[model samples]
Target: MTVGPAEARRLSWAQVRARRLAWHGLAEPLKGAGPADVASAMAGTHAQMMSAAELGIALRMDGATRADVREAVWGEHSLIKTFGPRGTVHLLPARELPMWVGALSALPRPSSPHADGVRMAPEQSEQVIAAVGDALRDAELTIDELTEEVVARTGPWAGDLVMPAFQGMWPRWRQSMHEAGIRGLLCFGAGRGRKVTYTSPRRFLPGFAAEEPEAALRGVVRSYLRAYGPSTPQRFAHWLNAPATWASELFASLEAELERVEVEGVDAPQWLAPDASASAFAVPRPRDVAADVPRGVRLLPYFDVYAYRVGNQPPALLYPGRASERVLRGNFQVLLVDGEVAGLWHQRRSGRRIEVTVEPLAPLSRARRSALDDQVARVGEILEARPTLTIGEVTVGGHA
Candidate 1:
């Protein structure tokens, strides 16, 4: 039987953060590490905004640049852009596509929100999914070309441009793109001029095939726990944008693999597992282990994966300071100090110069202020811009 939280020993949040920081590879930028390594470590680096996502990888990799990231995606074909956790776009390692494909395919999807006229029936949806794969076999096609292929295969109804998108409508068949992506039938291909293209995963991975759902789920769950564990079912559910009940059932099923513990001040229990890198319940004195935990000032781009955490955990437990909230989301660039959200920052670029504004939510020591200077310079290196720092209230409405 799994030990309950009450029976488990308590650890200070500082100790837990130390372990988490090590797991996140935040001690220093990794030398000679490629984009895929960082993506796998992050479980798949968030790529809703490719610029910021590239920065996320560069932050952990030594002397890396944006060109390296593009090369991984479009040149070396080692990373593929596809639907990731919470249905957002991410750059996933091509080698791990089997598990990512299988695990995402197994997740429950809500029925299409479009009205019946714009929505494809279950049978039609299946047909479109199949057609999408067949149309893209060993071929790359833009949205227009793919639509023509799908319409030809599934009939004119599938081509109806009725589903509302950002500023216009998308074809009825486009609704299945998410399923087509995770089903291992489709992935992003090189752009044709300015238009985005789609191609089969087989184009990059010759022997590509999704693993069994059960096995793949286990693999991904282990990866997730390794990077963000000591996490609760609810928090895991939230991170995956999955149903709380589904997460609860998945965790229950993995009881044998997980060990539970209660971090002081956190109302719910967290779970972690043994891995090659560290002990399961071994949060010790700072002197007892390698002191590679997160420290000093770091400027993280918007939508960085480290932003994941529950909102209710006491702010002081993570960010040392006077702060109101912990869950930083959307366009706000993160000013992370010592493994937590210390403030919010934003940047604007002109020619070769970038203007950075940082708002600290807590007090900073003199040494930390000096460190911020170095951090800003590093940001400049990643962005290939000269950075000018302004320490003041970021007046933007959302800190974007």
Candidate 2:
């Protein structure tokens, strides 16, 4: 049966609810990869926050000590494997770090200018790795402290070559640490001058290891597909920041575990679990429901993974092309209804009151307007203050 755009656009609330629940409900167990594995699974800062909030995990630091709400879920902080994915440091689960680092290392290096600038020789990379290990032997050092230690050990090489080399070899170093069974759960402790202290390495979670890099990648891919399936290869490639060639190869390698499905009547192809049913495409449920707002408008945080995923796809399911375009400006939060974006909103807090400025992409129907008001009220509850809603002029297509 062909699902037309109109039918897709008219998704029932129940269907939307089911899809949302399915997307965020499952958790992938990391038996051995440690904290690093968890960090690797989270691709960026926004991704990390969303993952943590969804999992009900809290990142906290006291004085000079750092920990999470549930230490048993991961492990103690390991400072050495903190900065990897795109050169940013993240707090990862301890056990799963090794395998995730290994998987990232297995990825082919890019020839892009940025990649070329960051490439390091094998010997130079090894020297920096060893130096870092020595610096953080028993105590955790902040980025600056660790960098200084690397310089002190390697002398002139440390100051000029080692520092630069470390940047290039970070990803590989993470892979090596994972291979050696080191976890990645480094956290921000107290700041000493400009340097920060981190937590020591200790087993945070049990049952994860770094062996079988290929198997680990396959497993991660499987989970991603299951949670965010009915998506195109291009989308997967974008999500991983991987080359198309590599993405296709990875998909081919996992063919036995994945099923290819047509996106209803569209020419687009999606990959899902072999056992996924047709109902998998049902719309998602509302993440939050406000008693005061109308039924249709919902506010979502900026860089919401949902917004990121659907940015380039068919608009029939959500906002029209113009509305989506306005949301892409990346300046404000989003307003969504029935799994589609309807407008943009900006929030300002003053004393006890919160001010909200909204710009709808199109003229709101009476039903949609009522739904929006209810959503605003929910926002008020979250901020612990009443909200003053201000509506902005609508913009259509490229014209305002």
Candidate 3:
């Protein structure tokens, strides 16, 4: 990539932080945005824990509730539940499914982690994906029901339950279920009591199809950069679980639409999508770099998209002070003050009350402490509960 005064630019870490906060709607709650609006803005919300996903979206909007997120997913059919970035379940905007499918389907599949005998062959894997789509074409089936149909159609071998999960073995065909979702062949259906169900994505938007690979690639990259830029190819790769080499080449392919930039304290160069709003490079105002840099207190739930800066450099940059300890554990709920992770927190809920325990790296100012209270109350509102605050150590390990 070419570097020059005309094209090259630099941003103080403060500028990047402020921009990211506003871009993510954490600077203030969005006024008219819906659940799908927030979901699409963040690319998608990690949804292995659906409640956490609902919280992630709800907490971003002005007075939005968990029920609002659920309605978007089930009642309004505006949000789709499917395997998204890095092959994890996510709540993606239904309107963006074509682009997600095209881009995700292009991701290189990881080699099987199972024993040779337990894994499917190349042709068998394809057959399993196709059968999954066909099985759920018209009906939403729970895991067991879908497994029975897959084995019946793809032959008895597909039902071999050998890969141990938590405790018991899971059906062999289950291994390819996520791949089916990425292929736009199937998606999550409404839960049947306690059981999760699977159905075709086509059920929500009939005649859906992925865009051309190149077009979809360009669209998703732009979408990601809009929410997470001024970023680097490596960080982008890590965010989507794509190879660094692939990200580099893809960025190279779109050179005309991107500009290289430097962030204070970052070793390697970064990239950003250029915009016309403020003309050349559209750099942040000088004051944003050093003063009043997006001050606010936010309680981000587990796997919150804005808090997960995948492969970010200088851990101190985001997870400052004691926050690193929590981040290292990998899944503690995050506490953000002034756009940086300043503490770690968790919540427990009873019938009408929520107990929030916060562990700050340093004593908070009266103003920030008050903001924290407001943030906690907002969390309770989203969950429809009364909130009580406690300041102490969190006694749990983290993983996601």
Candidate 4:
């Protein structure tokens, strides 16, 4: 087999898992770091679901409670929730919003020929973006309220651009909200009753200025590699939701900072920080799985960044063999033991009682079963509910 320039090293599956755990801050949870530290380590948490984001951050920090996270976000305002990498909701460190704003604002505006004549003109899009920032500057407003303010500022043309969407007729111009958030001009705010609200990131984090675009984007690339490297440009592109050509070009400019090395099981060259050593991949595996192989157990939450961001691999690899696509679709919400999907677990609360159910992909060893019990106790502690355990056969995509 011809090993090309891309195929520089071979990394065993164990080596891959070892490096992943270390990079993810899981091999050893961080000490004395706050929620922002955890966010910075992973670039950002997958935060479409607020609970998942909170759990993801807590898992990475020692002694961080739900209240601590809430304080950082709503009280101290150290973390900001907004649209981030890949145009998705994420929890980012408030201090870093300027850099994110600069980098994300540099991406080419999205256009869709498939739209039924409802797209915003580039100039109109910019106007809407500015309007969103201005409207939310004084106070948090619900989406409807924000839209009305935008319409009042940008006139009827902005309000008239509605298009069909899965959620039904959405104002085409409002798509710029994602852009506004990425540009550090807007973010999610505390709710009013059941109504979600938006506010300017500067409402709490003041005086942040966007860094020069190219330098800001270069920093983003560096952070991604720091958290998930020994990877290729293709993987970086996939994670960033950018064109492969764009990522490759960026990587080319970063040649002096990255060192290419061969991995045991991979066919392509992987790049890492020049100061990083291959010894990270040679760490001893846990004794339990070290013998029979593939050890370490964790009950990760829905959209945990760990499961969502594996480089180049299908997300299904997290689950066991022959697991149904339905199950794999829900895999991000499942339990993982040894880096592979081991089971499904869910929690429900009633009064002071929280019911947690587990359904393993297959029968587990005594050690793994004990590990599952420990996770159940930990879940109960995090939720502050007296938890009862239920174990059985779980049908994928069904209520736990």
Worst 10 residues of 4 by lDDT: 282-291
Question: Which 10-residue window in model 1 sums to the lowest lDDT?
Answer: 280-289
TM-score per candidate, in order? 0.89, 0.62, 0.93, 0.87
Model 3 agreement with the true structure over 1-400: per-residue lDDT tens digits: 4555456677777777777776566777655788887876677888988888888889888888999999999998999999999888899999899999999998766688888889889899999998998998899999899999999889888998877899799988888888999999989999999899989989889999998889999888877776677778888888888888998999989877876777789878777664324321122322343344667898888888344464345568888766776665578787888878887888888889999999888899999999999999999999989999998987766632
**Model 2 alpha-carbon drift over 4 Å, by segment:** 1-22, 25-99, 112-119, 157-208, 265-268, 274-296, 305-312, 315-319, 329-331, 351-353, 365-367, 377-388, 393-400
Among all windows of 10 consecutive residues in model 2, the one with the lowest summed lDDT is: 57-66
- Could you give candidate 2's per-residue lDDT for residues 1-400 as a string of tens digits? 3333344332232333234323332111223322333333333223233332212211111111113322432334332324334333434444445655556556565543324434445566566666665655556666656657666765544444321343363332333222122223333444467655643333232343454779767755654564455556667666656677887888877766665644433465555543323331222222232111223346654444342343124545445678656765543466665556677777677987978778877788888788778667766654456888889943332111
Which tens-of-lDDT digit does each residue in 1-400 have in candidate 4?
3334665444555555566665565655666678887787678777788877777777766656666777888888888889988899988888777888888878765455435567777788889988998888888999889889999989887776476668777766676778888888889999899899999877787777888998888777776766666678989877767788888998888877766656554666777653223331222222222123345667677777343345624444544475545356553466667766676777778987988777777788999889788777766666666888888755445322
Q: TM-score for candidate 4, please give it.
A: 0.87
Top model number, TM-score: 3
lDDT by residue for model 1 (182-280), tens: 898988888899898999989899989998999898878877876676677887778777788998999889988877776768878777765636432
**lDDT for model 4, on a 0 to 1 scale?**
0.71
Q: Mark the regions of model 4 whose C-alpha exceeds 4 Å error after superposition.
A: 1-10, 165-167, 274-294, 305-308, 312-320, 323-326, 396-400
- Report the error of model 3 at residue 340, Å: 1.2
Rank the models by TM-score, top first.
3, 1, 4, 2
